[model samples]
Every structure is written in structure tokens, then in C-alpha cells.
Target: MKNRHTPCTECRKQRRKCIQISPDQPCLRCQKLDKICARPENCALDPNNEVECLNQEVNELNQAIQRMEHELKTLGIKSPLYIKNNTMTLPRSTIENLFYNWKIKINNGYFTIDTGIKYISDLLPHYTSIEYLSPMTSYSSSSSEDSWSDGGSILIRFKSQEYGGFYGLTGKMLTKWIKKRMLGQQALLINHIPCGSRMLLDRLVDIYFNCHNLYCGWLHESSFRKRYSQLKEPLDDLICASLCCYVCATPCDHLDFNAYQRRDMCDYFYLKAKEKLVDQFDEPDKRLENICLDLRSEYEAAKVQTGIDYALFARHFSVAYCLRITLDCVVNKPITRQPIPFPVMNTLPDELEETKDFIRVMTWVNHLYEEPFVDMLVEQIHLILIGSTCTISFETVARMDQFLLDFGKNIPSEWRLCDNVFDEAKCRKALDQTTNPVAIHAFLHFAVLIVILYVTILQPVSVNDENDLLLQHIQRNALEKSLKMSRLLLYGVQRLFKLKTLSPCHVKLTSMIIMLYLVDPIVLQCSSPIKSSVLEAQKMFQKCLDIICNIRGIQREDTPPQLLAEKKDIKDFIHNGSVDIDYYDRFPDPWCALLHDVSQFFI
Candidate 1:
């Protein structure tokens, strides 16, 4: 028992005013911290203990002061007076507040730090108003509307010159920025595509507008056609080649080009586009006025797909983040435009219903990508992973599960998955009804995320009481429902792949899901009766590999020796079921490690 006036050791160390619950119990601070509360014995007589405790406190305070000073030096604050002097620019408190808010935004994964010209624009609020003014004159509010209207067009003559400076200069700057940021393979020289038939070119262009244009929606049809028809500049070729390359890489059907021909064409266009993209970076004087604002962002996004596939998630996320920041600048702007109608899409034949469904699903997915909720979801998951101060209870998990169910219910009937079964005929029917592959992918991802949540927090317990039994039952039901949902969505995705209606993006998503999400479950369940699930997962994995094999379409016999060998290596590995883990050593660390982790079981 401690004296009533004595404080706990923890409270004394922290210099907190502690209130004792009782003389025999811990102090309030120690109790709240779940720490042992020690009080000095015979405090009046034990002069050494008091001196030692005081010395310890002084040492700790000195260490803390040293740490803070070190942090201040690292932050470029030489001393307290240095920060005080800098208050002329921004008060220390204000700066600290800004930094604190910025940190919170970063931790929550929903922040935008404008870089380059965007930052300059943010600094100059009146930039747009004075953009067309002569450099010699100071910008004035009194400038005539007529003068502005007349000169705005002259100064910004080409749409490419909308951002001012030399034509295509921003593109060059962006390219450099991208290169600087990239951690993986740097793009080099790309060869131009050989001349092809006029009909083939037109078909590719048409396919892009009808099937794929919605995903990026970068180029306005009228503007793109105006430039594309003339072909007077590299922008026309860049847009055409990039779109053609993307379409060819994904699921598309054409009567003129055989599988081999299509593969060759895709390679040519992709390489040509890559060359053009490099030229965009290399040639500063090149005209890019025709490139739309959306196209510039798409240029970054295109790297995510047509480059090394889904291997660079960081790069993919970087592009998404850059796009978010770019949009956030104008998110609050009061501007409204009438929705552009897609008459060409309406004229599409019934046979392309699956493709249309794909477009819808991808568009929705892209929409979700631009939303802030994804960031919140990711941040919450991260907190849960790190076991942060905030505790998310099983009831919260149940609520989230219910929320997902409610969301699924609210989805249009046409977009809903039919069931978990992967029947060909039924899947085909469901595909016709459900046109959004992105939604299917999202459902699968969300289910997996929920299962992960359950696994992360679940603990072993004995069912000795009603509460224990209830907890066990909830855990069982939650896991089962989540796993079933995942299986159902996975099956749905499999159906799409089998039907050859899924896009290249889906291929990327599938690869990510298998490599990152499915491996553990499949491996752990191999010895269980649910071995059938493992087999299904294997089939899904095989389908992805098959897609990769034919990814560039069928290659001609004259394909380069290296590419031929590369294709052979993957093909043989897939068929032989070998455990040569070194075969995948070329992949990024995560992929290589994960593939190696699950190779034996999957094989």
C-alpha cells in the first residue's frame, strides 16, 4: 500500500498530476496506461531515492531537448530565434499547423502537392486572367474584354500552346519528371510501325472510339478526327498508334488480321507509339497543341498498362496519384458542361455486348479510382495492420460486411453476379446482363479485403459460454460469406476471360489478385476438402498465363530470336510445372518472392 499523498513512479516521470484510485491501488495515470505504479517507501527518510529519481527525470528531459534540437536542425531551423525570424513569411504556429495538416493528409493517403507549373499556377491566383497579356505590361483588371478575347486566341493559337511557352515543352518536362520518378525499366528508343492498309488503320481507329475511348476519354472525337484525318503532325500519329497498340493488346476481334498478323501489328504500333512518346520528351519544339489535357494524364496512365504490364504497382499508383492531384486543383471550380453524347457507342452491334459491358465496368472502376474513399479504405486497412490506437471491433467488421452487402444490393440488377458457379452457359448469360468487369473485379477485391480483416483480428477461443459460441459463430459466418463472395467474383472473372471479353486492364487486375491476394488461401487449403477451390484458383491462374502467352497476339515465325525464346521459356514453365524458381527471377521482388512462395502448391 502507498501513502495517500504519494504519486506513482510513472506519473512522476511523466510530470503528470496523478490521482490515486485508492491507497492500495494504482494511480489514475498508471491505471490508464496499464503500467505498474510504484511509490517510494519512507519518502521523508529516503533522500537518495528522491535524488536518483530527480536525476533520472533531468536526464530524460535533457535527452528530449537534444532530440527536439536535432529535429529542428534537420528541418533547417538553426535555433528558436531562427524560426521566430522566419515568422515574417509565415508565423511559426501557422507553419506548424500547415505541416501538421499536411502530415495528416499524407497519412490518410488523400493529399495533393502540386509540382512544376501547377505549383506556379497555384501561387499566382490571377494567372488565368492575365495569361494573354503582353509580357511588357503589368496585368490590370481594367484590360478590355475585347482585347482579351481577341488576343487569347492569338497567344494560345494552338491547343498545344494553351499552357504557353514553346509548343510541347510541358510534355517534355512531364516526360523528364516521369523518367526521374520511375524506379524500374527506363524506356529507350522505339521503332516506327511499318505502313499498313488504309482499311486496317480505319478499323483500329473505329475500334478505339467504340470499344476503348471511354476508359481514357482523353481525345474528343471531333478534335481527334480533325487532327487524325489531316495527319499533318506527330500528335495525330501518337494518338492513333497509342490507341491502336492498347486495343490490340486487349481482347478485340478483327476479320482482316489473323492472330499472328494482329500480334505483329500490335508490336509495331506499340513500339511506334513508344518512339513517339520518347520524341515528345526529346523534341521540345514539336507541336502538341492538339493533345488534350486528359491525353497528357492518359500518357502517364498508358505507362501503367502498355509498359511492363502489372508489375509496377508503384508506377500505376503514382500515375493515379498524379492524376488525382491534377484534378484536385480544379475540383472545387464552378464549371459545368453538358455531357457529351456517344452516338457511335449506341450504333455498336449486339455481338459486341460483352465489349460494351467491359467498357462500362472499366469506366466505373476508373471512377472509383478517382474517388477519395479508396484512400480512406487503404488508410483504415493500414491502421488495422499496424494495430494503431484506434481499435476496429468485430461489430465494425460486421457493419462493413453489411455495408458491402447493401452496396451490392443497390447495384443495378444487370451488373450483379449471378452466383459462384462457373457454368459456361450461365456465365455467358450473366456476362450479357453484367457488363462491368471493373465492378466484378472490385467485388472480388473487396471480398478479399474483408477476409483479410477477419483473419487479421480473429483469435482462438474456447466456446465455453453463450458469448463465446456467438463469437465463434460470427467469425465462421463472416469468413464463409467473404470467401464465398470472393470465389463467386473470381468465377465471374474467369468466365469473362474464358469468353475472351475481358480487357488488358482486367488481365493486370487478375495478375495482382492471384499474386497478392489468392496465394495464401490457395496454399493453406490445398490439403483440405476444399482442394476443389485450389484447382479453380489454379485454372484462374492458368487463364492469366494463357492471356500473357498470347498477350501480343500470335507471333509470326519471323519474330526476333530473343522474344521467341522468352515466350518459349514461359510456355514451357507453365506446361511442365517445373519448380525452377530462377525462371521468374527477372520479375520484381514482390512478384518473384510471392511466385516462389506459392510455386510448389500451385504447380
Candidate 2:
């Protein structure tokens, strides 16, 4: 209402350089910001009021600076960086190396920083080359052959089964690596199985790498700070490749492999499966030699195509394979006993098979560990528990209840929310649940370590039985193994509970077990169970009978038909403790809960 006053709408709400809307219809700043212009009362803001407020702010800021200066003067201290020498003097870094341990943070598993970085970098141009790329340059090269080479044995020999070294000089690394190497030689074996069995290895790799597409949105640290989408074409492709790589894992033997039971490998069929999988790859990426070339920046137009999602592939493959493996181990060696010793590398002092029983519990817990399901189920639970506005169906609740039965014993999870939720206790419980996806991963890994320890520590003593020292050493090694893993388990549990996303319930479970283990290793060992074995002879015998019975001649050179009945005898001999369904029914609720828990937490 004051004379010569600008309208509040134009001045503050519109943020325009306004004299008065009555004087001029258009506001200047509105045009600059490309916003719509309107009458003064269009907004609740008053321009004169805003000006006064701003002036007060300016005064406050000045006073704050003055106060800060006076405090600094009294203390005889200026800014924290107030050195007499204005010139910069970079001090020698105490840290030997400053490298980001940038790992691909997948829910169920993690990749080594070095492995992930190297693998992803392979898809992108060299750091130096990326710096030189101009928008004018093209990125026409989109061939695996142009990417990396058919490093003939590198994939199998280095990355595949003998995969223990995938993380660190981990105990599992040396052993698994060797195992895979041996398996890759299916051609030479007396009985050949699939070399890359189930093609899970590659699929896991593909899936993780493919997830890089999501990375394009991530802000970079540099000047442009561009999202992944803003990057040139090839870079995008490389990112896609990284995401896909995570998906591609080596598939394991199928559970239904009973129908296609393998017999003695005659060095012929062994070559077939290996060749078939390889031919599928057709043109192998033989860029191994020229992988160092930085030509992408110089040629090809900047056009890109989305790559694969190898992580998804690998995840699926892993789920199937791991399930198959779990079944194999359990089927081959069932734990009929009540209490099991936690598994030790060599042999425990007294009854270490008890340890293996604990591992059996871990296996049970694992069946529930499906990555995709966890996130979705967690979401529903969150909505039901926390969001009064949302209503979840009884059917959904039942399913979720079943999920809880399987894997929720120790995990504290959120009811509902989006983005960046970390429950350390739940994560710890997830890690400890034995049925966790990574536990199986670490299982295969620990197997390698056992193999190494056997080879390095136990094997030598067993082999060079010099003065009864071997058994003693083996016992000592076994004790150390149990203690070491127990410690890792304890640490993993503690760290897991601290996560923000975990619930108090999971923390309690983790703490309960942690308390037991911390209180007494002997008690934990007594309660723990043994790990199941991985090879089943029942299917083997059944298939062997089928093949022999199918023979035309009464006595063929390949396999004697007379031995068909003998095969059942062998099967009966191996599966001595096989019991009735009532045996499973007899299990109490807690055990039932454990089973359900595993089904949910593990895939």
C-alpha cells in the first residue's frame, strides 16, 4: 500500500528486478529465469519485507565475521591454515599408497577393489585416453575381440574354479584355483564332467559388470562431474560391460543331473561339453595382446549400444549352482547326529566332525538367501510395519512370515523406506546365517584354504610322518582353523549389528550367539554341526545301473551289465543312514524355524 513500493510478487516471490507491477507489467528477473510473470499479489511474499530481511542478514553476517576475528586475535590464532609461509608445502604422505578401495557393493556379495577396478577399467578407455577423447571422435569399436584376448587359459586357469585368489592370498584362493584348473582339464580325466560346469562363472561376471549402466548417473569428482549417460558412447558400453560381467558366473552341475548321470570319462565326451560352451562364445576376445592400445579415442563415431547384464546372469547362475551344490553336499552326507563340531581344516583334537555340523546349520540358513527377494520382502515388511497409510495382504504377510522363518532369526531389517538403509546387526546376521550367498562363496573359498593347509601344513606331516609329529601338527592346525574362523565370525557379527538398517531383534540373535562363542569356544564347538559333502554316489550308482542295463551284449567291454544289481548294493552301502520322512517331521520348531530362515536368507 506504500507509494512507489514494488509488488511483493515481482520482487521476492518472482525474484525480479521490479519497480512496480502497476508501473510495468513484466518483471526483469522473471525473464532472466524464464519464469512466468503475474500480478503483485500472485505470491504471498513482500518485496520490501524481503529487502529488510536481507539487510538484517547482511548485518548479522558482518557481526559474525567481526566476532570471529576478535576471538582469533585474542587467542593469537588465525584460521586453522594460518601458516607464516603462504606458499604451499605438501608434506610427504605417511600412507604408502592412497588408493580407493572402490568395490561393487552388491547386496549378497562384494568384489575385491582391485579386481573390480581392473575389470571395469578394461571396459573403459585408459584413464589417460579418456582424458583425450573429443566429442568429435567416434567410438565404433564394439567387439569383445577388440577388448580383451582369448587369454587361452586365463579365464579358466586364473578366474574360474581355482578362484581362491580372487580376493586375497586367502586360504580359499590357492585351493579353489587349483580345483578349477583340474576341473578345466575334463578332457584328460577318466570321467569328464562339464569343464565350466553350468556356465555360472562367466554369468556372475557378466551380471556385476552390466550394473554399470546405473553408474552413469553417479557424479564424478572432476570438472565436468558428468553422469555416466553424459560420457561418450564407448565409455557407456564399457560400463554396460562391467555391469554384465557381474551377472556372468560359472554354472554348476544341475540338480536334475541324475537323468544325465555321467559315467567314466573316456577323454572323448569330456572334450565335447568344453567345446560346446566355448563355441557358443564363437569369436573369442583375442585382444589380450593389444589390450593396451588406446585407439578408441582417435577413430569411430560416438555411437553406443547397451551391453549385457552379466551380474544378473551370474546371480541366476550362482543361485542355481549354489543350490545344486548345497543339495549335493547335504544329500551326499546327511548329519544324523544331534550336535556337530564346527568344521576345522585338518582334524579337531577330539570330535571335530561336530564343527561340520555347525556348518550344516549354516547351509540350512543359506537356502533362504536370495538377493532379489530380500529387498522386495524387506520393502513389504517396512510398509506394513511403519506406514499406516499402506495395507499389506494376509497372503503377502504369510509369505513374508515364511521368509522370516527361514532367514530372519538374527537379521534386523527395515519395514519400509527407499534408498541407503544399512542395518549392521542385520547385515551381520545376514553374513552369519551360514546360508548367505557369500557364505557358500566363502565355503568354496575356505575349501581352497583347507586344501592349502592340507598341502602346506597337514599334508607334509601326514606324508613325512617323521616322529608322530604329523598328527599333533594336524590337530594344532585344526584347532587354529576353528579359532580363526570363530574370530572372523565374531567380528563379522559385531560389525554387522552396527549397521543402520539392522533391527534390534537381529542384534539380539547375533549377540546371543556371539556371547556364547565369546564365552566359550568349546560350547560353540559342541553345539555346532559339520559341513555336508558335495558328491553323491546314489545318483552316480543309479545312472551307472541305467547305462549298464541299456547295454545290448551280456558282457560288454565298456560296462558289465551283471554289475547293475551290484550298483544298488553300493548305493545302499553309501547311503547307510538314509531315513524316513518322519525323521524330518520329528524336528522341533526351532529347527523348523532354522530351515525356514535359511530358505529366506539364502537362495
Candidate 3:
């Protein structure tokens, strides 16, 4: 009896019958062609045995579906938008009713604000307050859910405070001030929302972020809810949206392309970001040198206004930080099979092949900065100032860039690399806690983190009274000193996380990790059981070690086995100050506090 499963091609081409190996590989037929050949992809099973195979396949698929359903049920997570499982439990009539009301307010000045949105709910309770309603405390809970809070309790409403020697204006006073600023203009009044409303709406149109637009219309009093998709992809800013357009013509004059229309605006920014490093590309000196000049000019302007030499110090100020951030990403991901020891080198003392990856990332960042990165900074300044109601323009970026180039060129070689080492312990401690957000957050939020500080943290402080001028001056100095102390901490973080990789050309890499709300103070707090923050401090130190070991070139095998076995001792050689508190004792408590704060964030 001959094997019936043998392929005819195998027998004819190979001059032998097929064995039909479990993971069928190339038979002699493919060998002659010098190409990969395998069992036919769509070959059917024996027709006589077809039902058996079909039944088995059906069972396997059923088992998989069951497992997934069980997992979802156990996890208490609804498949909000999955095609098979997603369903809108809400009535269509309810949604249509809301859209009716929102339609009238689409272009209204009041709808664009924080106060006039109340009518949305009263018109159709389901869409506004009933469908997606959640409480303040609820935001702090929930997983795999989209929840964000930009302000504390005072953000949505007005609160009154008694003036008995203890006070600034109450929430009521602030509201009045903002209202007066608007002066007869309309504002939105939206606060409460419906429960599970986000889930229902997301199911209808398919979105989870709860960020896009919602339309409203007028319908029967019995049914006032309706929903419609806004016709544009969500974008973080108008500038980014304009940049992403592929249409050769200007935005208003041309039709928008729908090619990547399904992608969220946030994803689109990164997609475009990976393309130009910004919205523009640089050709060596043409792009980069022009950027540096622009930045230096901005720095000079800032310096003249405040005597803080924003231009002279900004580049040096940014160097270590930028390196840590860009390098960390590349170094940790290896190119070779070697056992990579971590506690990545905080500084590149010598150039090595392993360090190549990190250098490449650095080159990209450098190019990026010299490219549209300068534009981003300029745009960022405009955003902060405009949103906060101040005045600024691209002129500042140009000044800062020019000033920095001169300052950096004039800097002594040793100073350029932090060779002077004033209080090396301080820098190391700062370096040690670069990865921990909790420590950094608490430090930044310490003492003056009240309402006033939120508004004043980076603003100029002015006092009108002559009698209290001296006291006010002292407070102002303290704030400025604190800011400088924070910057020193930031530099430590940037330099330490630099990475290395193998690339055709040598690359220099450096970076600093800036996290969003989810993985940060929140995760930092969640990692430990203790609430006193002492546990947080320990975690900070622990995280620093993890990142150090992540450096591309540094590994246990490269160093002496004995030293590698005792990691702490080796780390001391690089940064011994981190483990010792006594050396830091001589420094002012504020400085120590800042270091402590910086360290606490990573662990």
C-alpha cells in the first residue's frame, strides 16, 4: 500500500514519495528550484474524513471563544466595542434626542466654554448626565478605563471662603473674575454627566477616549437625544492638524484627505512625528544651525527681561536631560545576543561598539532639535502664554537659539561635560531618582502646592504694597531658587538614561523620562503598601538601579565577575554618593529635600 497523502508534485519533482512531516518543510521539488516549497496552503483533508476534521476545528474555535468570554467575565471588563460582543444597551431614541439639542449650540459662543452646557442634560438626561456620569472619587478608581481630571474640586464650581486674616479670593471670587474677563460673552455650564454614558456613546460610534465632539438637536419632548460623528479626526492642536494634511492646497481651500481618517489625532501626530522629528526636516547646518540661532535669540530676550541668561544656560541646561530621554529607548533594546548587564553607564567615558545604539538616538534628537524641534519650542511658548492669557511670539525662540549657540561655543570643555563636579553627590542623587514620578511629583507639589501656586508656579510675582515689599521679595527669591534646584535634578535624570546601540554611524544618545498621569505618581503610589512616602523613597532608589542596568553597553559580563557579583560597590565607583546620606548632610535642607524628592520619583 502506498501513502495516499503524498503530494503528486513531490513524487514527480523529487523522484520520491512525500513523508508529510508534521511542520511540512521543503521536499526535493523546492530544492531544485532553490526556493521554499511546502504542502499546499488550502489543501483539503480527505473528503471521507472531512466531517471529522471540521468537527475538531469547530471544537477548537469554540474552546477559544469560550476561554476569551470567561476571561472577559472574570476580569469584569465588557468588550465595549468588539464586533461580536459590543452592543449598545441604550435606546436609540434617547441618543437622537440629545443630538437634537446639541445641534443648536454647535457654533454658539456659550457652548465653547465651561458654563452653558447644562441645557444639554436637561434637554436629554441620557446623553449628558445619565449615560456617562461618574463622581470625582470614581476617577481615582477604575482600570482600563478612560478617566482624567485636570483640576481639583474647585475646577467645576465656585466656593466661598471667610476673610479673617486668612485668605485670597474664594472660588466664587475667581469665577467672578473669569466671568468679568468674558464680560457679557456666553459660557458653558456643564458639570454632572450620566452613568456609563461614555460606554454607550463609545459603542454607538466606536471611541474610548471621550475627547471628540458631540452634536445635539431638537426633537419631540418625549425623545430629545441624538448623536452624530464630527467630521474631523481628533487632533491635539490646530497646528498639528494643518501639518498632517496631505492636500497640496491650504486647509480652508482644499478638501481633507481621508486616507488615515480612522486613526486618532494623537496617533497621527506621532506618525507624522516619526517622519520629520517635527513637521520639518533638517539638512545638517541648514536646518540645525538655523534652529540654534533662533533658540539663542529667545534665550537672550528672556535674560534681558529677567537677568537669568535663558540663552546662556538653556542649552547646557537641556543637554543631559535630552540625552537621557533619547538614549534610554535605544540602549535597553540590544542588537547582539550577549548577556547585557544593566545599571547602564550614567556617562559615556569611552566610545565602544555597544554604545553605538545610544549615540544614534542622540544624533536623531540633535537633528530633531535643529530641525522643527525649534519650531515646537516656539509653538509651545505661544500655547502656554496664550492659554494663560499672557503675550509671546516666535521672536523669543529665535533670540533664545542665538544666545545659546554663543554661550555653548564659549563654554570651557570641562564645564561642557559636568567635569567641575560641584557637590557630585547632589547630581548623583538627582540621577538616582530619574525614573520615579511619585517622588518628583510630591517634591514639585510640596508646601506651596495650594491653589495660588498652581497659577503662580512659573509666573512673575508682583506686590503692590511698599510696607510688605521686603517680605514679598524674600518669597520671590525662594521660588526662583527652588526652580533652579529643580533644574539641577532634571539634568541628572537626562544624562543617566542615555543608551547605546550598533548603527552604521556612531550615535550619541541621551534622554529623560517624562510620564503621563497613569504610570506616574499614581503607579508610584500603587506599588507600595505604605502611604508615608518612605516606601516611595525606597522604590525611587530601586528604579534608578533598574534603569542604570538598562544602558546598552554596560552589563555584568563586561565587568569583573567579583565586582559584578557585588553590584553596589561597582555603582559606587560610578556614583557612590547615592547610597550615602551623610555626605549630603552638609548641604542645605532645601537642597537635600530636592534631591530626596528627585530620587523618590523613580523608585
Give the winner by TM-score: 1 or 2.
1
lDDT of 2 by residue, 1-603 (tens): 223344445346523345433445555545544556556553444667756766676666668769976774544333333342223333334111222333333221222234343232142323323222222122323243322222221110001011111011111223333354333444343333442333432332332223321211111122122333354431123333332222221111221122112222212233444444333332235343233223432454355322222223222333344344323323322212211111111211222332333333334333333333433333222221111112222233224324433433333222111111123344344455543322322332232222222111211112233524534544444344444444434445445444544333333333442332232222222221232111121222222223222221112333234422231221221123222222222222212222222222111
Better of 1 and 2 by lDDT: 1
The TM-score between candidate 3 and the true structure equals: 0.18
Give the TM-scores of the predictions, in the order they appear: 0.40, 0.21, 0.18
lDDT of each: 0.44, 0.30, 0.30
Best by TM-score: 1
Clashes of 2: 125
In model 3, which runs have C-alpha deviations exceeding 4 angstroms?
1-44, 47-55, 63-603
Write down the worst ten-residue block by lDDT for model 3.
Answer: 210-219
lDDT of 3 by residue, 1-603 (tens): 222454645444544444444445665445544544545654655654755655676666668769976775544343332332223345677656544555422221122323334321122324333323212222244342111121221111101111100011122223333444321211211124221143332332221111111100001111112212332322322322333321111111112222112122223333433434432322345457557854653443332322123322332334544334323322321112111111121212232322333333233334334433343333222222112212222233224334433433433332232222233355456445454322222222221111111112223223245424543443343233333333343344444334221111111111112211111222222222235433543544444334333422233343345432432232331122233232322222212222333344334
TM-score of 2: 0.21
RMSD of 3: 31.7
Cα RMSD of predicted structure 2:
30.1
